[model samples]
Target: MMGQLYSVGRNIEAKVMKFVSKALIVSLMGASLLAGAAHAATTDKKIALSNNYAGNSWRQAMLKSFESVGKKAVADKVVAKVDVFTTADRAVPTQAAQIQNLILQRYNAIVLNASSPSALNGAVRQACSAGIIVVSFDSIVTEPCAWRITVDYNAMGRQQVAELARLQPKGGNLLEIRGLAGTSTDAKIHGGITEGLKNYPQFKVVRSVTGDWDQTTAQKNISAVLPSLPPIVGVVSQGGDGYGAAQAFAAARKPRPTIMLGNRQDELAWWQQQKQDGYRTWSASISPGISSFAFWVAQQILDGKPVPKDITIPYLAFTQENFEAELKAIPKGGVASKDYTQAGAIAIITKK
Candidate 1:
C-alpha cells in the first residue's frame, strides 16, 4: 500500500513540473513578442526632407548632415528610402506646394525646415491628416501636428550679450547683425537681444543691419552702414554674420570689436587667428546636425515610439579656451556637428 501511494505521488510531481515548464516557455514567448512590437521594423518606411532654403552655408551644412545620416539609414536597411527637396525661395506658398507634392508622392514622413512658424500650419496639418509624419527642425513650424527640434534661440541671443559683458566689461556701442527677414527664428533672437540690453545697460546698440544670415550679405550690409556709425566697441551678430562683421570692420578701417561667432569652419578658423592676437570672444549656434537628430525622431515616431511634440537641443558653444578641438573635429569645409543613431534616438525618447 505504501509503495503504491508513493508511486502515485511521484507521478503527480512529474506532471506538475511539465506543466510549469510549458508555462515558463509561454511567458517568455509573450515577452519576446512585446519586445519585437516595441522595435517594430522601420525597413519599409520612406522619408523625405522639405527644406525651405539652401542659400547659406548653415543651410547647406544642415542638408549635408541630413543626407549623411539618411544615406546610411538607407544602406543599413534602417529605412527604405530618404530624399531631399529644397524650395527655390523662402516663400510660404512655395514650401506649401512642395509639401503638397510630397504628400501626393505617398511618403511616410516629411522632414521640414520651415520658412515661417505659423504659415506652414496648413500644409503640416494636411500631411498629418494624410497619416504622414512631419518633423520640423531649426526653422520649425508652429503646428501642433508637427514635431519640432530646435535650441533655445532666444536664450542664445541673450547669452551672446552676457558673454560680451564678460569679455568687454566696459561696454560701448554695439553693431547688431540680424538674420533672415520675416522668420520666427530671426524675431525670437532679436527679441532676446533686445531683452538682454535691459539687463546690461552699459551696452548700446547704436546700429542694426539685416545680415540675412549670409556672410557676403552681412559684409555688404555692415560695410554699407559702417561709414555712418559711431566707434562701435562690439558687434552682436546672429550666427554666419560674425566673421562677415569682422571683415566689414576691417574693410571700413574701423577698430576691431568683440564679435560673438557661430560654429562655422571659417568662423572657428578666423577665431583661432584672432586668439593669437589676444582677441577673446565666444561662439555659439544651433548645430546643423540637428537635421540628423530630427531624422531619428521622425523614424522613432514611425517605429511606434511615444515622442514629445517639442524637443530642444543644446546649442553648440565655443570659447577662446576650448574651440580648437572642435575646429579640428569638423571637416575643413564643414560646420561643427554631431549625428544621431537609432540607439541615440531611443535614449532621448526613453528619458523623455
Candidate 2:
C-alpha cells in the first residue's frame, strides 16, 4: 500500500510539470506577437516639400495648408517628419540643387512646386532612380516618372476670355494681366487666351503687363500704365491681381470696365461692396490647397498604395449668384471656400 501511494504521487507531479510547460510556451508566443505589432505601429516615414517660390500671398497660403496636413500625419504616425524648402529667387538651378539634397537625406518622397516644367526633369529622374517618389503640384515638373497634380490652366484662361467677349460683344480694347514671365503655366494660359480671342476678331489686347501674381505689384504697375493707355473697356486677369486692378481703376476715377475676377478673399469682398452699386462679375481660380493634396498623395504612396501618375484637379468657379455665400464660408485671408481633406485628395487618384 505504501509503494502504490508513492507511485501515485510521482504521477501527479509529472502531470503538473507538463501543464506548466505548455502554459509557458503559450505566454512567450503572445509576448512576441505584441512586440511585433508595436514595432509596426511606430515605423517612421519622412517626406519633403520643395517649393520654388513663396513670394506672394497665394504661395504663403499654400505652404500653410501643407503644414496643417503634415502636422496631422505626424500625430497619427502616418509620417515621422515633414521638411519644407523654398527658393525665393525662383531659379531652376537652385531648385535642382535642393532636390539633390533631399535625395542625400533619404527622404521617402518629395512634393515639388517646380520652377520650370523641363528644367527639373533630370533631377526628378535621379530621385526616382534612387527609389524616392516625386509628386508635383501647382507649377509642375514634366518628368514622366513623377506624379503630377494640376488644374486645366489652359481651360481657365479660355473661360476668362470667353466671359470678357460676352461682356463686350461689339469688341473693344482689353487690358491683359499676365502671370510670371517664363512658367509653363503662364505659357499655357497665354496660348489659351490667344486661341479664345480668335473667335472675337473685333476685340484686341492693347496693353499686356506682368503682375507677377501679386496685389501690390499689380496695383503699382497698372496704376502707372493707366495714365498712358486709351480708355479700357474690359480687363482679363490671372489670379492674385484682380482686386488691385479694380483699386487702380477706382483711384484713377475711370469707369470700371467689365473685369474677370480671381479667387481671392479681398477680391470677393470688393465684389460684395460693389454689389450695392449694381456691379457684377465672374471669378475663377486654381485652389491654393493643392499643396495639401500633393502631401496626401505622398502619404498614400509611402503606405504602399497604388496611385495615378497624372492627376488633374479642376479650377473652382463662382458666379455672381454664389460669390457672396462662398466668400462668407472662408476664413479671413483664406484663398478657397473649401479646405482640403485626406479623403478628398485620395479620391483624385485614378484607378487602373
Number of clashing pairs per prediction, in order: 0, 0
For model 2, how does the per-residue alpha-carbon lDDT over 1-352 read when each residue is reduced to its tens digit?
2212222233444444543453455446675333222212123778899998887667887888898888876765557888888989989999999999999999989999998889999999999999999999988888998999888888888888888777677889989898888877778777878888888887899999888777888888999899888988888888888988999999998889887888898889988998898887789888778888889888767655567888888788898889998888666765663447756875666433
Model 2: runs farther than 4 Å from truth? 1-43, 165-171, 199-202, 329-334
lDDT of 1 by residue, 57-112 (tens): 67888899899999998876668899989987889999999999999999999999
Per-model CA lDDT versus the true structure:
0.83, 0.79
The deviation in Å at residue 327 for candidate 2 is: 2.7
TM-score of 1: 0.83
In terms of TM-score, how similar is model 2 to the real structure? Answer: 0.79
- Clashing residue pairs for model 2: none
